[model samples]
Target: MEELTAKKDFTDIYTQESPYEYLKETRRLQYRIPDSTKPLYLSLAEQLYNKLHKPVNVLDLGSSYGINSALMKYNLTMSQLDDFFLKEKELTKEQARQFFQKK
Candidate 1:
């Protein structure tokens, strides 16, 4: 009723537009740099990995594009990911062919 209507605007994520809208739309990707916090997250993941042993798995709730999983599984760096998905490089036929060929 009136109480519910008077509640704060907690559901509106669009109140402040996203800064990485272009990256999200064009590349179908979302970016969130963990920066100094990466080590902490990695350390926690390592602990969990050790507890579970080989074939460690992680469930990143808000992970954009699951970059943390990639980092944990493949040891890929953020710089490498950035280089791999440069905005200037359009998807080519050969690239598309090779992508599907690997599997």
Candidate 2:
């Protein structure tokens, strides 16, 4: 069997001053695990909601920029998030607030 090894230590990336910059670097590196797993997380949340018959609180460990919370709460796909962050890169605080308020 072929062995897999990590090529880089991403500890430095985690220490970026801006979360957006970290996300941009991760995106550039094609780190799309969260995007791929979003469906599974959403399904699990749905199952929990169905079983509990109430709001389900999710704790996202190592949440970083709260991507999981934003994805679930806004019902957004990773592509949408990428577009928002990458394309609309200069949004002011109020604009971002209003944008998410619409979501």
Candidate 3:
């Protein structure tokens, strides 16, 4: 526990008093995703899409408000994305489990 609480560097998760707090929070609220993961996700998505030569499906964990899903759809040329999302929003708990599980 003591080791976990010790401060290491600016990027360390345990560094609560870092000056990057506002910048981090701003990004989290804007995209509903962490700014730190921007490069990783973008690079992977592009690479995977290119490899498959088709649209890539991503399973966004902790998908609060489904904002990431919306953003992903925006990157694709699909018809009626809102209709698809509306159907997903109406899913029951069991249905939701199946939906995410298939991802």
* TM-score for all models, in order of appearance: 0.47, 0.74, 0.34
Q: Write the per-residue lDDT of candidate 1 for residues 10-103, one digit (tens) a residue.
A: 2342232331333333234333454445777788878887888875556876655555655555565554545444534465557534533443
lDDT value for model 2 = 0.74
Please state the error at residue 20 of candidate 3 in Å.
23
Question: Clashing residue pairs, candidate 3?
Answer: none
- Summarize candidate 2's per-residue lDDT along 1-60 as a digit string, tens digits: 233385646577678543556667666777777877888998999999999999889998
**lDDT winner:** 2
Extract clashing residue pairs from model 2.
Answer: none
Kindly report which residue stretches of model 3 are placed more than 4 angstroms away from their true locations once superposed.
Answer: 1-33, 70-103
Give per-residue lDDT, candidate 3, residue 102.
Answer: 50
Instruction: Judge candidate 3 against the unseen true structure and give its global Cα lDDT, from 0 to 1.
Output: 0.46
lDDT of 3 by residue, 9-70 (tens): 42442344321332333333342233345456778999998999998878877533343554
Report the C-alpha displacement of residue 52, candidate 2, in angstroms. 1.3
Give the root-mean-square deviation of each candidate in angstroms.
9.9, 3.8, 12.4
RMSD of 1: 9.9
